[model samples]
Target: MAAANSVWISLLVSIIIVILFIQAVPTAHSQNDEDQLIWAKRVVSGNQVITNLQFYFHDVVGGRNPSAIRIAEAPQTKNSTTFFGSLMMIDDALTVGPDPASKPVGRARGMYGSAGQTDFGLIMALSYVFSDGIYDGSSFSMLSINPATETVREMAVVGGTGLFRMARGYAIARTYWLNAATGDAIVGYNVTILTYV
Candidate 1:
């Protein structure tokens, strides 16, 4: 009878301790919770601003200090008609004009790979880092497949930082100049971005 009473008393104390612990622990809706895992609230919408930018991309692949360089490639990349599987790292210049001596605006830094086996398609993942005028310290990112032979190519401006926060839009690229011997080129970009003001 004494042992049974002791067991009952111990069990009752354990239940009380568990109950106190549960009450001490914070729940999702606890009022005194300083840290929370989830939150939801409504925010005002339709405060987007559209910005249009134009610039020239100078891809210097032939000079002693080339801006773009081939980093990796498949065994058949050199002989492949489309240069498929070839990857190149680029830190090309963004200028106000097509001329290489034009005013410097920014840099196009990224990697592009020839991904198409039959077509001259390049998968580009580039960031346009700006340091001129209103877009100073701002950068926009692009990830798209560019059909190299197309007269005009369209690329998505997925996101951005600084002044272009939450940016989304498109960019149009056109060949401004090319050197057949050196494989150098100046490409013009017209980008339209919609960002949160």
Candidate 2:
């Protein structure tokens, strides 16, 4: 009886050891892990829109690459009209002229002729190529601005070339100043984006 009892005790101890071992070993489905196995977000997964990006646009003849010799040179259509192509410089404040007195950070070059049949002459779609700061090689289009809603304008990010190839996004712009005399404007923008390279 003593031997039998000892044998039984040994078996019980062995079973307890097995149970403890199983619990101690890490299991894929265990809920006791300090950290779970998961994939992390990639670095290029997100980018922020640089806010308060300022620019000054001077509506002058030959201002754009296509060259709007004059405002009348703009296309006049029943459903749309074209405005002069404009060149602007990105600055830090509400600038008015092409020659920025101060706070010039980058330069913008591209076509900005307006089109579409919108009674608001100021209301039209514009495309401009950005050549400074993080906007290098990327061009964004102010698809259209409703004078009624000119307080906030959305610029469509068309595809880019080179470093900015396959760019997709939009820019939020607020007009800081508008000169009725020359059709010049000071605009501010905020952009958020992501790129592969």
Candidate 3:
């Protein structure tokens, strides 16, 4: 009877341990997800100006023209509040020339410099799917407009979070620098591009 009782007690202890483990796992996962969300929010809020400026350029350039542009993959989020976003510098030189469909002019005058203008800074914010949720933190990168290739390659964070499915949302802002001599003539334009997955 003593031996039987001891075995029963041991079995009970083992069952209790298993139960505790199962309960703890979910809590840990929840905490991790929460922490990620917080980090993302901080990043997004910190760069609000950059994000706003990019959108302003997007509006001015309109979808018809491909001014300075950067494209990035969307971020992944289990819920509505979690997402990723990015900003890119715009290169106007690539887009200023005559449309490829049009005949070449006798001499193409350089509207802007060979290299397009760079943004003061680009900022991005990840948007939540639901209207009520807060924006997720943003991922940042620098953009270089390559006239030869007619492409804007985002340098910083190129292979990082901005390129993966982990990014679910994005926003962009751009600032244009005008020449004082030209009386605030639009000398340089900055563009920010945002994407949401």
Candidate 4:
């Protein structure tokens, strides 16, 4: 009886350990997802629309190369537009700079462009090449638009030629979020364009 009781206690302890491990694994994964969502929400709320975006370099090993780029955009209610208005502009250069005078230039149009077309022209121009978990190339400047005035404003630069150029393809992953109040029609259409230069 004593031996049998000891064996049962050991089995119960093992089962408890397994249960704890299973629970901990998911909590760790959830933490990462939570961080991503928080960052996405912050990008959606900040002013200077398209306020802050960043890129990081991953050390390469052997013959393998690694890098990443993170692109974020924040469109405030003030910049929100009607279903028929323009949302952003993409130029041929890294336009957004520390100085307000150094912003890039691009034609302004609606999110879907004229006639309700999917204008991935900006993403195409920036993403010159796409490969397995890697995007090799460079892109120009990106500009944001003011829905009210329809004027182009310097929002942020994805990949510039100078110091900013090093940030190309630094973000290996991306996440996008839209305000809950903004109906799915308009929310799903808004995008932040980044170059994998």
Candidate 5:
């Protein structure tokens, strides 16, 4: 009977500890959420710092092992001049140089859709996941329109994880090389981010 009483006490203590721990941890609330304006608590703390990064993205759209593949399309996509309503998923390589043989540092994984009816524009929603150097295991989310005809375009950096928690900024992307026949391209990216240091 005494041993059974001790076991119950231990279980009660553990339950109390778990409750306290849960209460001590704050819940996450999005800044854009309406409820956040009423009851949001400060959860992140660090010195605000800006960092600039430069890299290259290699997109292989053709060949046996392609990085970008068309996943869906509208009924009239083949007949449309802009390929509107087409969607593609990509796992493109991020490299240190414009050449595909250059050292790989990370990957860009996401989906892009041809949403423009009159122009060749893509709505990009991707994450730049890093795997090299100080940025290992870090990643940032990007969302913006990529005007394929433009020489340069700016992409929005909305949020991130790991070393770039709560990140926000922009990335300037420029086409470095392109194969009109194969639909393969190398794009250079210059990213500027405001993040916690």
Candidate 6:
């Protein structure tokens, strides 16, 4: 009789401990929801202006070598791959020439992969950096732009630095002018940024 009572008590204690453990364990969704709530405490946003984004792209193997693979690959490109860089003058107008006194607000530089890489329209990945004024050192990624189309283009702003730390946003790239023949162009950008600042 005493032995039976002791066994019953041990079983009851095990069951109680199991019940407590089950209650303590949190579901995946509950943990994810809690994290989301925590990150929402801070967020700041503003518009970033960039204008007269200009660059010249050239491929040497295409033209200099008569027996080259191809001078370019595009509407009329000579080189399939090229490394290029540009200074985006910070002026608001949609005109061709930026004011001489206007400062270069950002930088656009990157390499172009082969045309076979269908991931991006332009098949190039570029980085934009804010060098002067209030946003110095804050840089963002530029995803891709299809050179074939001249309509309002778009690029993704993945992340940033400095005042724009932890920033994420998108940019509207408008092709003011594009020379399919020479791969030269003038573009404008209006970017909306979200950050901790």
Winner on lDDT between 1 and 3 is: 1
Per-residue alpha-carbon lDDT of candidate 3 for residues 42-124, written as tens digits (9 for 90 to 100): 11222221121111111122355544333442343222221123332343321111222222111111112122223322232
Off by over 4 Å in 4: 1-87, 90-159, 165-167, 183-197
| Per-residue alpha-carbon lDDT of candidate 4 for residues 1-197, written as tens digits (9 for 90 to 100) | 99999878876865565455333332112322432321111111111112122221111111222121113333432343432222232211211221213322212111222112222122212321211111223223333222212222123334543222433222221212222352111101112332222
lDDT of 3 at 3: 100
lDDT of 1 by residue, 1-197 (tens): 99999878876865565455434432223323323311111122245455667678998889799999999999999899898999999999997666677667899999999999999999999999998767778999999999877989999999999977888989888988889788799997877676775
Q: Name the candidate, 1 or 6, with the larger lDDT value.
A: 1
Q: Give lDDT tens digits, candidate 2, residues 68-175.
A: 333333333323433323222222222222243533333444333333244342433454555554645555444444342257766655544554455555666666
TM-score of 3: 0.18
Write model 5 residue lDDT over 1-197, tens digit each, in one string: 99999878876865565455435433323334422221111122235555566678998999999999999999999999889999999999997666676667899999999989999999999999989777889899999899987999998999998877899989888988999989899987877676876
Order the candidates by lDDT, highest first — what do you get?
5, 1, 6, 2, 3, 4
Q: Give the TM-score of candidate 6.
A: 0.47
Model 5 lDDT, residue 129, Cα: 94
Between 4 and 5, whose TM-score is larger?
A: 5
List runs of model 2 lying over 4 Å from the truth: 1-43, 46-99, 114-118, 121-149
Q: For model 2, where is the 10-residue window of minimal lDDT?
A: 37-46
Better of 2 and 4 by TM-score: 2
Better of 1 and 3 by TM-score: 1
Task: Quantify all predictions' global Cα lDDT against the true fold.
Answer: 0.78, 0.41, 0.27, 0.26, 0.79, 0.43
Clashing pairs in 1: none
